[model samples]
Target chain A: MTGHEERFDSVAAYALGALPPAEAAAIKEHLQTCALCREEYAYLRPAVTAVAYSAEACTDAGSGAVAVSPLLKSRIMKRVRSEAASREAARRIWPAYALAAACVAIAIVTGLTDLSLNRQNDAQRQTIADLAAPDARRHFFAGGEVVTHGGRIYIAMRNLPALPAGRVFQAWTLARGATRVAPSSTFAPGSGGVAVVALPEAATNIAAVAVSVEPYGGSSQPTTKPIAVVRI
Target chain B: MERVRLRDADAFEALYDGYHRLVYGVAMRVLADPGAAEDVTQAVFLKVWSSPALFQGGSFGAWIARVARNRAVDLARSRSSHGESQLDETLVVEEDLEDTALANIDGERVRKALARLPVEQREPIELGFFGGATQDQIARQTGLPLGTVKTRIRTGLRRLRNALEDALTV
Candidate 1:
């Protein structure tokens, strides 16, 4: 046998009090063939004997064989019986739990696709909510981008009402100098209606924020009046 | 001794019969006052019966000892609020804990002697107090290397034996 297999056999024999039984009686043993294992056992025997003997010295009632009285055993058996009953009760309700879990999974998946595209748009809504101080999530940042940070205005629109095929929506900052609107973000109806039009931060005393429906591509100038506006 | 997870008369009786001494012993060992120990023992078994799931897959003795230990510690702290001193070291806990509790059975000189060893040596001595959890459980719980845990327990035990023997004499 391999060295490891031989070594483990010796220790196992030592642990179980069987080393002498095999060497003294068993015929055709490996230890009889190997002298090294014999020599190791000679030294290991005393060490093992000393260890086995040490546990014997400890003997007070506090040290060994703690008694479990019959009364306690009866109490334990009663608890087990009642707990078994409740576990049966829980097993009976498992079908309802499975059904509830399925419903929750379905709702979670349906909510996923709308999530990614709306995440940034949602953040803009959060900014508005921050300003509005809305108590609820639905009332906050409805949706939009920073139209004015410092003295520059930028607007990003997503999922807004689209123009006829080849048409686009034009957005305006509507401040004093930005009264004359410029070509802003391009939005396709079927494709994602999302983009930012340059709306530079102009006068500090701005009027409002607005989006206007324009022609194919966009209006060379202002055409339709702003569809939605919030007076700042 | 008493059945903790269920409301059954025999279970209650058995639990009361078997563990009353352990619970009382733990409380007495930790709290020292007879009245406080008895009260803590009553409260511990009451909770044990109500929350049986807390001991799921765990040893009954370990679970009961923990409950007794916790309740006793709480009672000891409460007593301190009433102007009593903190629990003394000589409190004689039931044998189950006191047997394995090297510090409790032999006394704190062993613990103090243990504390004198390096941190690496002191930890395995503490591990012996964990009654039922395996060495691997301790390694996983403490996030220590597996070999390190084994070595510390073995090497530290040897040192503790040498030191504790001397300390016991002192």
Candidate 2:
């Protein structure tokens, strides 16, 4: 109430989450400069929470129409348990995952076989998602969200087939001798194909992308040649 | 899970354990039909079991409500297409507004109470409860004056709170 009308209106709009992106950004910048509007924004939180909670309370508490059978209850509980078990297993397998990751890195670097440093660079630029069998041509990667919105690579591959599980798939970065394999990446295909792995955002200098099939859970690095390679 | 996946026994059982009634209540309140409510309830639980991953964000109640709202909204659209229908004109399932939240506030009861509200107030409430729209989005979609919509929400909340309070006490 410091006689700042525009500031007041902006705060209200922000509380309602109705401001356009540009306006929202402007208001955010303005608030940093104005103490009055900042205080009001803080005061609006409780009201928003109250509005949300009140709406949720409207359903009737006594309706004979909805009834659950005993047989059905047990079924849902079992599914939850199994999913819980799998999450636990994933958590425990990290050490093995780390060791395997190391071996793959050495193969690509030491073997001096493939100088596909450009593959990693291309991954960032083209935002390549998944790799498939060389002969099998598919634009998008297998089991990945192809975001046509931006030029960045944002792959989220989960549970990809393990290298040792047969067939090697190595992720590489393009630069110089200091080539480092992506540590954040994971691969293991379940019934739905490997778990999704999200690669780094796109950058300039990216030249190529490749995925080679190697030993179980894949080798610490590429064993021979790449089954998939694309020049960006 | 394998067994549950086969027959959806676990998800169905969750449906049986009061979650169904609550979801059914939400759908019926919005769509106002016994058969449609039942259909939505079944679909929500079925989806939950079929792809538990879809609603795996920690807040189970919010996830369930979202699924129920989508089904209800779809039903509402079809009913609207028929024209001049009571927005809440689905089959009347019996209901009592008063019942404890965890004790016996069945789904239909909540739905029936929702049906009693005016659309101006009810639409936003439904969307928020169902997670389809934020308060501001609801105002924009309904074309109600923002202050007026907010007021209606406040009043609606008071009424809903009264009903819930009675239920919890009884």
Candidate 3:
């Protein structure tokens, strides 16, 4: 057989994961540009995948039938239910934001102007003070600014859409020479879709800052893609 | 899947009930430890619950089985230095299988199909796929040449594939 044909012969082994790494990498690269090999790989894939099913018949040498513990199902369901309840609680709180937003809109429509303007003024002042720090370094992101000064970080964001229930925006930092992002803080925007969150971690050693939407209580790792990332 | 995506616990429970055996079975086969198998099974299902969208499209059974096996293999590798092989993620087909007949295939059908494969072909496949052994390792254990082991696996799988297609159509 030709060299290409010889390589193609290994597709089944590749599908079954029997090929070693170097040979598998070669087949993967070849599949990228070679439609014929891709077709063969696709054809063989399901059959190999079906091999996993044969495992269902796995049995113990002494036991009559190998079965999972009855309690295991309850254990799994308990965690599932707890997560669902957390999600449900998050759903319930979300409507409170909507009601608060509606009340603000009604107040504005009814000419309750001073209260709204005062809140805006306070926000503006905070933004000014944050940006005017003598040592502050400002970096702009998609919808926000991250300002670092006096060993602290200030994140000012605007026009962020309200998150679904059980979800919050979480901030992450990557330390210099570190490969993974570290969890920093979590926050939800106000009814006006604006937030100014302060993080106490020193910014000098930080390489980058990112924000992603995660479930309530946040995750150790970013569960969703980052909405914003700014290099320091 | 759509209901589970909406966080419907009942729907997810139904999914778990239907396939938990296959998942636990795969893990048990690889890990041979009830505790480790249970851990892998829990992790696999939780992953489905948290990231239902990870399964873009395809047979849920096949997708989950692969997930169970891979997770068990990872755990096994972590506990030992045996140099187990891993499923190449790139070769995992997210799209529909070429033979849709295999889409909803269950353990019984597959068990029968595999039983029909020659022992030579079946041995290498079982060792490589479920046991996470490399072709070389399988060759060492079975005292067969590497090329012979490779050929048997290829021929065995092709036969199993045809057998599945024929059985499903019937």
Rank the models by DockQ, top first: 3, 2, 1
| Maximum-TM-score candidate | 3
Clashing pairs in 3: none
TM-score per model over all chains: 0.26, 0.36, 0.65
Cα displacement (angstroms), candidate 3, residue A209, comes to 6.8
Minimum summed lDDT over a 10-residue window in model 2 chain B is located at: B92-101
Window of ten residues with lowest summed lDDT in model 3 chain B: B87-96
The complex in candidate 2 yields a DockQ of: 0.08
| Candidate 2 Cα misplacement greater than 4 A, ranges | A1-232, B1-18, B33-63, B78-150, B162-170
Estimate, for each residue in A13-122, the C-alpha lDDT of model 1 and write its tens digit. 33212223343233124445556644443323322222222211111346542222334335545655565565444334323332233222222212333556566345
Predicted complexes: DockQ each? 0.04, 0.08, 0.48
Candidate 2's displacement at residue A106, Å, is 7.8
On residues A70-148, what C-alpha lDDT tens digit does candidate 2 reach at each position?
Answer: 4333454565566545434433442244223323332332232354766544432332222221111222344332221
Which candidate model has the greater DockQ, 1 or 3? 3
lDDT of each structure? Answer: 0.43, 0.45, 0.74
Candidate 1 interface RMSD after superposing interface residues: 16.1
Question: Looking at every candidate separately, what fraction of the true A–B Cα contacts under 8 Å does it contain?
Answer: 0.00, 0.05, 0.67
What lDDT score is found at residue A200 in candidate 3? 50
**lDDT of candidate 3?**
0.74
Residue A158, candidate 1: alpha-carbon lDDT: 43
